[model samples]
Target chain A: MRNITLSKAVNEALAEEMRLDSTVILMGEDVAEAGTPFKVTSGLVEEFGTTRVIDTPISEPGFTGLAVGAAMTGLRPVVDIMFGDFLFLIMDQLCNQAAKTHYMSGGKLTVPMVVRTNMGATRRSAAQHSQSLHALVAHIPGIKVAMPSSAYEAKGLMKTAIRDNNPVIIFEDKLMYQDKAPVPEQEYLIPFGAAHILREGSDITLVATSSMVQVAQAAALHLAEQGVSAEVIDPRTIAPLDEETILTSVKKTSRAIVIDEGHQSYGVTAEIAARIAEKAFYHLDAPVQRLGAMDVPIPFSPALEDLTVPTPDDVVARALMAMRGELFHAL
Target chain B: MAKPAQKNSDAYLHMYRQMVKIRVFEDSANELYLTAKMPGLTHMYSGQEAVAVGICEALETRDKITSTHRGHGHCVAKGANFKQMFCELLGKDEGYCHGKGGSMHIADQANGNLGANAIVGGSAGIATGAALTAKTLGTGDVAVCFFGDGALGQGLLYECMNMAALWDLPVIYACENNLYGEYTHVSEMAAGALMDRASAFGIEGHEVDGQDVLAVNELSQQLVARARNGEGPFFMLLNTYRYHGHHVGDINRAYYRSKEEETFWKETRDPITNFGDWLVTEKLASFDELQALHAEIKTEAKAAVNYALSAAYPAVEDVTEHVFAETV
Candidate 1:
C-alpha cells in the first residue's frame, strides 16, 4: 500500500488505463500541457504523449461533443470538464448526445467515455465555481454518476469508470483532492452501485456521498462519545444507487439520515430520503432525516458559504435527533 | 475550367438511381403521414437529393458522414436499406432504433453513418471528432458533416471547424444552403458570405450547383481526396432548395415564401429532372431507360412501406431495453 493524495490517485488511474489500452485518450483545456487548473493531469502528457493526452481549446460544448463522437467511433475518451459547474455549458452534449446515444441507436452504438469533473465549495470560488450539481446528472438516465470519497475510492472508481462501456461522469471533490489515504499498489476496481460501509452501529445510519463521507464519519465519532452508535454508508455511485445496502442499513438501524453537499430540495439527499421512506416505511423507528446544503446559492463570504453546506456538527445534530425519536413528529 | 471526358454510363445511371430513390422514398413518406399511416414528424429531403447523392458518391463505404434533421437522403445515400428506414418511420420493431428514435435519429454505425442530429449544428463536432479518431488511429477515413444553411450561425460549428483546421483533421463540412433557416431567410440569419466561414479558419471552401448532381460529385471527389490525403478539412456550400416545406406539417409556407419563387425553382432547378435531362442529352441512357428505373424504384418503395406496415411494434417490456449497453 502507498499513501497518496486523491489527485494523485486520479492521475495514476488515467496513466494506468492509458498504458493498458491504446484507445484511451484524454482531452480538456490545458489537460495536456498544464494538467488542468487543479493540476490533476499534470504529468500525463509526458508519459502518454500529446496524441493520447490532448489539450483542447476552451470550448466546453465543442470539445464535449467531440469527445462523445470520438467515443462513438473508436476511441475511449476521458474528457476533463475542469469544473463540475461548467457542466451546464455542455449539457446538450452530455445529457442529449452522450447519455442517449446507446438507447437512441437501439444498442447499435455505445459511448465508452468518462467526463472527469470537480465539485464542492470550500475554496471560496463563489457561486459559479463552487456548486455541486451531481444530482442534475443523476436524474438523467443512461449516464452513470460516480463520486469518490477518498484516495482509495477515487483510484478504484476512476479505473472502473474508464473501463465501462457506457458514458460515466466522475465528480471528484475539489476540496478532497489533497487529502491523503492508503491505496493499494496493484490495480483494483470498485464496481458501480456498491455502497461501502465505513462503520457499523445500531442506533442509526448516516448515508453520505463524496466528501460528505468524511463529514459523516466525523459525526459518527462524535456520536460514539455520547453513547450513540451510528453506522456510516458511502454510496460511491449516485445513479446506480446501492438501494439494497441503503435499505438493509436502514432496516438494521430503523432510522437514517442522508447527508449531501447539493441543495436539500429535489437533490440527492431528498431522493435517498424519499426512497428510505417508501421502501422501509415499516422498518423505521423515526422519519428519515436529510441534511444537505441550503437552497440558497453558495456565497463568496467565508462565513455565509461555510454555513450554507452541512458540517459534522449538523450531521451529529441530525443523528441525535433521529436517535432520540424527536425527528418523527418534526417530519 | 475544362470539362472532363464523358463519364461511364453506369456511374450516371447509379447517380440517377440514388436521386430517384431519395425522391420516391420521401414522397411515399409524405403520403403516409398525410394518410395517417405513419406517426410522428418528418423532415423531407426533397429537392436536395443531388447534394446528398453527389457528395456521398465520392465517399467510400468506410468513410463516415454526419447528417442533419432532414436526413433520409443522407441515410439512403450512405447505403441504408429502404425497408429498415420505413420500419423506423413507422415505429416498428425492425427499425434502426426499434421505434425509439423515429425520424430524426436514424443511424447506421456499421455503414459509417454517424446518425442524424436534430440540433442545427450538433453533428459538426461529432464529424470533427470522428476525423480526429481517424487521424489518431491512422484509419485513412474521412468524415463529412451534412448540415443546412440554418446551422451557419451556430458557434459550435465554427468551434469545430477551427479545431479541425488547426489540427489538419480529415473532415468535410457540407453546407446545403437551401435559401432558408427553417422559417427565416438565410440572408436575414447570416452575415457576409457562407464560404467565408471556412476561409476565416484558413480552410479551403467552395460552392457548387446543388441541383447539378454531376457538379456536386465532381467537387466532392476533389474535397474527399484532399481529406483522405491528409490535406486537412474542406468546406463546400451546396446551393440548393427544398421543394417541400421544412417539415410535413409545414405545408402552408405562403406566409414565409412566395408561390412564384417556389415554382421558379421547382420547374427549372429540380435536381432529378435536370439530371434525367442530362442523362438523355449526354446519351448516357435513353428517356425510356430512365422511366423504367423510376418505375422500378417506386415498386421497391411501395414494397418497403408494405413491409413496415405489417411489421410489429416493439414489445412493451422491451421499452426499457437498450438504455445501457450493459445494465449496471
Candidate 2:
C-alpha cells in the first residue's frame, strides 16, 4: 500500500483508466488545461493529449447531456463539475435524462458515465458554492451516488463508478482531498453499496457520509479519551444505501447519530434515520438523532457558516447525547 | 449512363399509407375523446400529418426521433405499432410502456423511437444529446426533433441549437410552426423568424410549405442525406396549422382565434387534401387508390381501438415496477 492524498488517488485512477480504455475521455470546464478546480486531474492532459482530456465550454447542461449521449452509444465519459452547487444548472440532464435513459428506453441503452464533483462546507465558498445536495440525486431512481472519505476509497470507488453500467455521481469532499490514506498500488475497485466501518465500539454507532466521515472519526477519537467508544460508519454511496451494515451496527449499539453536510429535512440523514426507525426501532435505546446543516441557504459568512454546518464538536455532542439516552431536538 | 433508379413506387406508397394512417388515427382519437369514450387529454395531430411523414420518410429504420406533445402523427409516421399506441393511451398492461407512459410520453427505443415529451421544448436538448451519441459512437445515425413554434422561444432550444452547431452533430430540428403557440399567435410570441434564429447559430435552416408533402420530403431527403454524410445538422420550420384546439380540455368556440381564420387555414391548408389533390391532378396517383388507402387506414385504426379496449389493465403491484432497471 502506498500513502497518497485523496486528490492524487483520483488522479491516479483517471490516468490508469484512460491508459486502459481508449474510449474513456474526460471533459469539464477546466479539466484539461487548468488541471481541475481541485488539481485532482493534474498532468492528465499532458499524459493523454487534448483528444482524451477535453476542456468543454462552461455549458454544464449541454456537455453533461452530450456525455450521457456519448456514454449511451459506446464511449465512457468522465465529466467533472467544478462545484457541486452548480449541479442545479444541469439537473434536468443529470436527474431526468441520464438517470432515466436506460429505463425509459426499455433497457435498450445504458449510460456508463461518471460525474466527479466536490462537495463540502469548508472554504467559505458561500451559499451557492458550499452545499451538499446528493440527497436530491439519491431520490432519483436509476442514478448511483458515491461519496468517498479517504484516498484509498476514492481510487477504488472512482474506478468502480467509471466501469459501472449506470450513471454514477461521485461526490468528493473538498476538505478530504488533502487528507492522506494508504491506497493500494495495484489495480482495484471498491464495490458500490458497501459501508466501511471506520471504528468499532459498543457505545454508539455514528453514521456519516462524504466529509462527515472525517468529522465522525475525529469525534470518535475524542470520545475515546472520555472512555466512551463510538463506532463510525462511512456509507460510501447514498442511493444504493448499505442499510444492512447501518442496521446491524445500530442494533448492536442500540444508539445512533447520522452526520450529514446537507439540510436535515428529507435529506440523506433523514432517510437513513427513517430506515433505522423502520427496521431497528425496537433495538434503539434512544431516539435517532441527526447532526446536519440547518434548513437554509448555506451562509457566506465564516462564522454563520460554521454555526450552520455540523462540525466534529457538534457530532460528538450529538453522539454523546444519544449514548446518554438524551433526545435533543434541533431541526 | 446513370444506374437505373430503384423502384421507389413501393416506398412512396408506403409513406402515403402511413401519413393517411396518422390522420385517420388522430381524427378517430379526437372523436373518441369528444364522445367521452377515452379518458385523459388528447392532443390532436389532424392537419400536420405531412410534416412528420415527410421527414420520417427520409430516415432509415434505425435513425431516432424525439417528438412533442402532438406526437401521434410522428409515432404513426415512424411505423410505431398502432395497437400498442392505442393500448398506451388506454393505460393498459399490454401498453408500450405498460401504462406508465400515455399519449404524451409514448416511446419505443428499440425501433429508434426515442420518446415524445410533454414539455413544449423539452425534446430538442434530448434529441441533440441523442445525435451526439450517434456521432460519438460512429453509428452513422441521426436524430430528428419535432417541436412547435412555441418551442422556438425556449432557451433550451437555443442552447441545443448552439451546441449542435458548435459540434456539427447529426440532428434535424423539425419545427412544425402550425401558426399558433397554444392560444397566442406565433407572430406576437416569437421575437424573430426561425430561419434567422438558425442562421444566428451558424446552422442551416429552411422554411417549407407544410401543406406540400413533396416539398418537405424532397428537402428532408437532402438534409437527412447530408447528416448521414457527416455534414452537420438541419432545421426546417414547417409552416402549417392545427385543425383542432391545442388540447382536448380547451375546445371552447371563442377564446383567441377567430372562426374565420381557423376555417380559412383548415379548408385551404389541409396537408392530406393538398397532397391528394396534387397526386390526382399531376397524374402521380389515382383517386380510387387514395380512397382505398384511406379506407384501409380507417379499418386499421378501428382495430387498434378495439385491441386497446380489450387489453387488460396492469395489476396494482406492477405500478411500482420498472422505476429503475433491475440490473444497473
Winner by DockQ: 1
Best by lDDT: 1
A207-278, model 1: which lDDT tens digit per residue? 999999999999999999999999999999998999999999999999999999998999999999999999
Write model 1 residue lDDT over B1-328, tens digit each, in one string.
1242367889888989999999999999999999999898899999999999999999999999999999999999999989999999998999988888888999988788989998889988889989999999999999999999999989889889988988899999999999988898999999998888989999999998999998899989988998999997999999999888889999899989999999999999999998898779878799999999999999999999999999999999988998878835
**In candidate 2 chain B, what residue range of length 10 has the lowest lDDT sum?**
B1-10
Best by TM-score: 1
TM-scores, all candidates, are 0.98, 0.94
lDDT of residue B203 for candidate 1? 94
Candidate 2, residue A91: the lDDT equals 87
lDDT (Cα, tens digit) per residue for candidate 2, span A1-331: 6799999999999999999987888988889879987898989999998767877778887778767766765678999999999899878888877887665544556778999997888588898888888988999998999998889989999998888888999999887888999988889988999999989999899999988888899999999988888999999998789999999999999989999988988898899999999999999898988778899888888878888878888877777777676656553
Q: DockQ for the candidate 1 complex? A: 0.74
Sum up the clashes in candidate 2: 0
Angstrom error at residue B78, model 2: 1.7
Candidate 2 to truth, TM: 0.94
User: What DockQ does model 2 achieve?
Assistant: 0.37
- Model 2 chain A weakest 10-residue run by lDDT: A101-110
